[model samples]
Target: MTSSIRRIPRRMPGWAKVLTAFVLVLVVLFAGVRLAVLPGLRDLFGTETQDRSGPALLKSIQDMSRYDAASGNFQVVVDLEKDAKYLPDVLHGSRTLYVGAGTVDAYVDLGRLGGNDVTVDADRTSATLRLPHARLGKPALDPDRSYAVSKQRGLLDRLGDLFSDNPNSEQAVQKLAVRHIGEAAKDSGLTARAETNTTDMLQGLLSSLGFKEVHITYRS
Candidate 1:
C-alpha cells in the first residue's frame, strides 16, 4: 500500500497579513459610516443657519438727487475656472458656478439740470425743456437671492483652506456678477424707457400748470 503525503499551504507574511487586516477594517468603517451613521448625523444636524451679527450702525446719509424712472432686474450664471501653468486641474485648479441676482436703476439726474434748461414762451402757454440723457446706476446685488451653485477645488487648494480664515470668500464671483449685470443693463434699453417716463411725467406736470404746449428734448 502506498502512503499518501499531505502538503501544507505556506503562511502569509506578517506585513501582508497586517495590510490585509487594515484594508478590511477601513472597508468596514467606511461602510458603517456611509450606510448608517451619516444619515442619522445629518438628520440630527439639518442645514439650519443662525444669525449672530450685531445691530447695524447708522452712518452718515446723503440725499438722493436722481429720479429712478426705470429699474431692470437681472440674473446671471457665472462659471469661473483657474488652473496651474503646468499642473492638471485635479492637483492645482478650482472651478466655481455661481448664480447672481441683482437690479439696475435708470435715473435722470435732476440735480444736473441747468438754470436755463427750462424756457417759457412770452405767451405763457408754451414751454421747452432741455434734459440730459438718462444714466444707469450701479448694480445692486441681492445678498439673500444670490448664491453659489457649486464649487470644486484641487487637492492643494483644499489643503490650504485648513489654515485660511475665510476659505470661501465670494468676492471675485460677486465682482464678475456685478460686471455682467451692468453689461446686461446697458443693452436692455432701460435708459430709453427711463427717459420716456421722465418726459411723460414732466409733460403731465407742466400741462397741469396751464402750459398747453410742452416741448422736451434730451442732450448727450
Candidate 2:
C-alpha cells in the first residue's frame, strides 16, 4: 500500500500541470492589465476631465500691475510723449478707457488741445464708460479721430455684424490713425506708447479693485 501511494504521487497527469501553468500566466497578465494598461489608457483619453478652471488669455495679459494696499489702488504711469496724438484720440475720442475696479479716470493736457477727463466704471464682465465730452476735429466724427465703442450681442449677431460693416471705410480709418499716431509718437519723443503698456496695467489695477477678470476692447 505504501509503494502504490508513492507511484500515484509520481504519476500526476500532465494536463493538470499544464492547466496550473496556464492559470499562473493568466493571474500575472490580469495584474499587469489592472496596474499598467488601464491607467495608461485612462490618461490618454481622459485629459479633459483634469482641472479646467484657470485664468483666461486676456486676463493674464491684463493683471501685470502691483497694487498699493494702503491707497486701495493700482497705479501705472504712462508717459505720453512718444504717441501724444494717438493717446488723446484713443483715450478720449475713441472711448477706450481702462476698465477695472472702482473707476478709471484719465487726465490729459496736450498744449493747445487742452485737457480732457475720461472715466470708466468697473462692471464685473465689462466696463461702462461715461464720456462727458469728447471732441475730435469735426466734433462729430473724423477719420483721424480715434474712438472706441462697446457692444454686446449674441455670438451669431457679432459674426454677422463683422461682415455687414463697410470694410473699406474701416480700413481707411485704421490706416490713417496708425500713420498719424506713428508720426505723433516720433514727434513727442516717447520711447513707448501708452496703448502698448495699458493692457497689463489696467488688468493689475482691476485685480486690486477685487476683479478676477477684465476684458478691454478698442472701438471706432
Candidate 3:
C-alpha cells in the first residue's frame, strides 16, 4: 500500500495583497494626521507664545529719535477668541480666549528733517519750514498692565496646545489692540496737534534768533 499527502498553497492571492497594502497606507495616513497635522491645524485656528518673565517681559520698543513733539497715549481693552474645527458645519469644535488692558503710544518726530526743510526769508527777519508727515512707530505692550481676559478650550484644542510651539495668543490680541488705538489716535487729529506744537517751538526759537516774521509749512 502507498500513502499520499496534500500541501496547501503558500503564496498570497493578488486581491489579498492589494487589500493588505491598502490597510498599511491607511494606517500611515492616520498616524500622520494624528501626530503632525493635528497640532498645526489647532494653531492654524489658534495662537500661542513663549512665557517670558521679569524685565525681559517688560520689553520697551521706541524710536531712538531724541525729539518727541506730541504724544498720544491710549488705553485699550481687547477681548478676543478663536475656534478650530476639523469639521465646521455640524458642531463648534474649537475654543476661544480673551486678552485685556492693552496700551499704545503715538508721537510726532521733529528730529527727522531734510537738510533744505528750513528756509529763511531774505532779510533774516522771516523763516519758513517744511516738515514730513507724521507716522506711527512699533507697538510696545506693557505686560504688567495687560491680562488674560479669559479662555475656553475644547478637549482637542487643549490637547493641541500641549505640543504647539507658536507665539503667545495674548500677544496677538495685544498687538491688535494697540493697532486699533494707533489708528484711532491718528484719526483724532494727533498729528495735527503735533504739527502745531512743533511750529510754536520753532517760531519761538526763530524769534530768539532775531527773526521777526516766521512762515511754517508741512511738505505733506
Query: lDDT values of the candidates?
Result: 0.91, 0.37, 0.64
lDDT of 2 by residue, 1-220 (tens): 3554444457659999998986876686466557656757656554365677877555344432222111111222111211234334333222212111111122211222212322344556444222122111111123232332332233333234447855212343344444444343343423223332444566677778876656543322
- Give me the overall lDDT of model 2: 0.37
- Candidate 1 is scored at a TM of 0.77
Pairs in steric clash, model 2: 62-203, 82-185, 82-190, 93-147, 94-146, 94-147, 94-148, 148-219
Pick the winner on TM-score between candidates 1 and 2: 1
Candidate 2: stretches off by over 4 Å: 1-184, 187-192
Runs in model 1 deviating more than 4 A are 1-37, 43-52
Q: Candidate 1 residues 1-220, lDDT tens each? A: 9999999999999999999986876686466557655767656655778999999999999998888999999999999999999998887899999999999999998888898998999989999999999999999999999999999988678667757999978889999999999999999999999999999999999999999999999988
Pull out the clashing pairs in model 3.
Answer: 43-46, 48-167, 48-168, 49-167, 49-168
Model 1: how far residue 5 lies from native, Å? 39
The deviation in Å at residue 200 for candidate 3 is 1.5
Sum up the clashes in candidate 1. Answer: 0
Residue 197 local lDDT, model 3: 77
Candidate 3 regions off by >4 Å? 1-66, 85-116, 165-169
Q: How do all models score by TM-score? A: 0.77, 0.19, 0.57
